[model samples]
Target: MVTIQGIAFIPQNISKGGEKLYILNKQDVPIVDGLINLNSDSSQANLSEAQQQLDLLWNKLDLIEMNDELKAISPAMAQGKIDKRLIIVHRYIRLNYGEPLTLQLLADLINCNPVYLSNTYTKLFKITPMKYLQVTRMKKASELLKETNMSIKDITTHLGYVNNSQFSTIFKRYFSCTPVEYRRNQHLQMRSIGIF
Candidate 1:
């Protein structure tokens, strides 16, 4: 699973060396949620059901990304396919987004020059590494706001922001609403759907 610009994609490699990335929207989130729930059953029937759900997810996804997007996502075949370091950095971001991260820190992880890392990352990902990190944190913030009882003040520190005001500013910019407002709306929606 990969998320960019508030969208999640389930990327599957083709039979050969290439890959096809299926773009999933907010509406397809249930497919992922169901997949997680179905994963715990450990039965043949559940496995079949899980496979059907995956098929349904694939059916619901949009087509492969455009050439420009694919280019940003992957380097040319001549450049040794994809950079291993970038993959490491991306995976690191997904795992540790709650912590404070800087370009120098990310570059130090792979023993590369900071400027080179930033430039190459943007060329490959179409966004600066820090921007990627912010988006990642915002995504996690939304999940926490909706699913956890942690107060907004605590969530601010948990997400590595200096204070509530800063977190609120960024959250509002990202979601067009304060964190509390987003959480309330999410709860209302969930209640309406009989999930709460």
Candidate 2:
């Protein structure tokens, strides 16, 4: 999912997360649809036009009145002209982040060399595949800790960790708190803001 500006945009099925995001204005729907349709075209000329469409999207977005309830949608269009294989690899990572994933395995998804995949992925996304997986895992762990009542062991298992200590160690390294402490802190912050 791509969150442009402050709006949540789901790139479900095609790439990234599959869950839907917030409600968008009726007028803005066409802009989102246009961009999707524009970028999905692979012809060189249309792809160039798609870049213009993306630019137009930014200009149109500046006029949107954002609110707590706004939502966005997309077909997982990679910005400008991008290698389609990267899109496939990206979507796979998001959908299967819970599984034991590796750079070689991700490269296998496209029958490409691991080194080539690593370099291209890093060049395009500005992060290595393994790093993205770690980030994605941490992000999922954070969501589970704050939003679900799953136990630490259960969460660790769901995240493909072999044991709680390993998960806790990584969690603390990324978040500066253990899973339990993080959950408690989130609850405290929510209560302070009247969310509880």
Candidate 3:
């Protein structure tokens, strides 16, 4: 699953800890419809679904380029880029998502005012830093679920959640499926593609 921003790429794998595992950018860059796996293992009927999705996305992006007058310019160009503040926030989210981090705590760590951090993050990411951290945690948890056999309780404790309930709630909310469901899907996918 992809997030609101295209930069993050969450794979089908779910962590035993109930977080979403992100794909490496080198193997999968954040292009349009990049979530469409080129080698999806999910139990979907077609193994080539990912490739087809990629072709469709590429065509759509191509059409937009062809129709727009900006063809002379680089369609790959990024405009309205984020500032350094957002970069710091993203880094913080990556580094501390599994920890019991608070906004105030992050502000203090970064030597910025909490309000300023909140405002900047909201303006740029369209979500608070906490939300980003939650997403990050979920992503990592999903990865663990797919790649490891650690118990669910162990995953929850590792992520620093108060208990399994909190972890389940967040995991369910984001994935629209329980951690187990996500894991099952990943297992089926892996088996279908002979990854297991």
Candidate 4:
């Protein structure tokens, strides 16, 4: 059984080399950004139902055989395949920046080993995945500080920080100012410009 974001599936027939199955979730499906440990019996039952539907669909579709030319392509030529997964990871980080995220959890979400994912992501984006995640969080926090009246503690908790001090520390490290100082500076700048 393989699960992505709490949705589980049982592969009826998996090839020795593994088959790529692209899943497009519905628009309304709640996106889970955190780690989901599926150990309950209900989760198992849901997986079984989903697998039955997938198998039925597979049996109904006509399978196509790849040509020898396509089959002859080396694994090195297939490097482009990782590009989409990397983009997905980036989008997930942007959407779920408030969620608890770690290298292993992100790799598990994408079905890749953490080391490989880290190396490939860093190579392609010129930034480590965790670094990117931190940047995303900080950016969102900055926006919240500039635009909202939420307290620093509230903002910190909203961004999934364990405490105000840690949030303030990271915010200062990233923006060269603490949250309160940043907000005060923003307001002062706006007032100086006669916009407040």
Best by lDDT: 1
Model 3 lDDT at residue 51: 49
Candidate that scores best on TM-score: 1
* Order of candidate numbers by lDDT, starting with the best: 1, 2, 3, 4
TM-score between model 3 and native? 0.56
**lDDT, candidate 1, at 64:** 30
Which segments of model 1 are wrong by more than 4 Å? 1-78
Write the number of the candidate with greater lDDT, choosing between 3 and 4. 3
lDDT per residue (tens digit) for residues 113-141 in model 3: 99988987776555688887887688678
Number of colliding residue pairs in model 2: 2
The lDDT of model 2 is 0.72
Clashes of each: 0, 2, 14, 0
Using TM-score as the measure, name the better of candidate 2 and candidate 3: 2
User: Positional deviation of 57 in candidate 1, in angstroms?
Assistant: 9.5
User: Which regions in candidate 4 have their CA more than 4 angstroms from the true location?
Assistant: 1-81
**Model 2, 83-141: lDDT tens per residue?**
67986887688678889888999999999999999998887666788887887799789
Global Cα lDDT for candidate 4: 0.65
Tens digits of per-residue lDDT, candidate 1, 58-138, equal: 444422343335556654635785677986887787678878888899999999999988888887787789998898789
- Superposed Cα RMSD, model 1: 9.4
lDDT of each: 0.76, 0.72, 0.66, 0.65
Clashing pairs in model 2, backbone N/Cα/C closer than 3 A: 22-71, 23-71
